[model samples]
Target: SCCPGWSATARSQLTATSASQVQAILLPQPP
Candidate 1:
């Protein structure tokens, strides 16, 4: 039986992408 190991990698990539996007929009603006 093959386990779904790629899901972990995908999740990590998704998290990184989400974090970067959030920072790009929310962290670069001047207060």
Candidate 2:
């Protein structure tokens, strides 16, 4: 399990990936 801070990091990464759009193609989406 992750801590509360992990959510912030995940959100940031999500934002970055969403902006780049290529990350989803490079990596498989987690389930």
Candidate 3:
């Protein structure tokens, strides 16, 4: 499940930054 503000964060970050950065945030590497 995504975080509560995931959508908002995504929208803001997506426009403010690059899609690559957003993708990295959305699909994080497993530790």
Top-down TM-score ranking: 1, 2, 3
* lDDT string, candidate 2, 1-31, tens digits: 4599999999999999787777667776898
Give TM per candidate: 0.70, 0.55, 0.38
Q: Which structure among the candidates has the greatest TM-score?
A: 1
- Which stretches of model 2 miss by more than 4 angstroms? 22-31
TM-score: model 3 vs. ground truth: 0.38
Give me the displacement of residue 23 in model 3, in angstroms: 20
Candidate 1 residue 5 Cα shift, in angstroms, is 2.1
Q: Which of 1 and 2 is the better model by lDDT? A: 1
What are the per-residue Cα lDDT tens digits for candidate 3 across 1-31? 3687988887888787786777779987687
Candidate ranking under lDDT, highest first, comes to 1, 2, 3
- Give residue 31's lDDT in candidate 3 (0 to 100): 79
Off by over 4 Å in 3: 18-31
Report the lDDT tens digits of candidate 1 across residue range 1-31: 2558788888999999999999988888676
Least lDDT summed over 10 consecutive residues: which range in candidate 3? 14-23
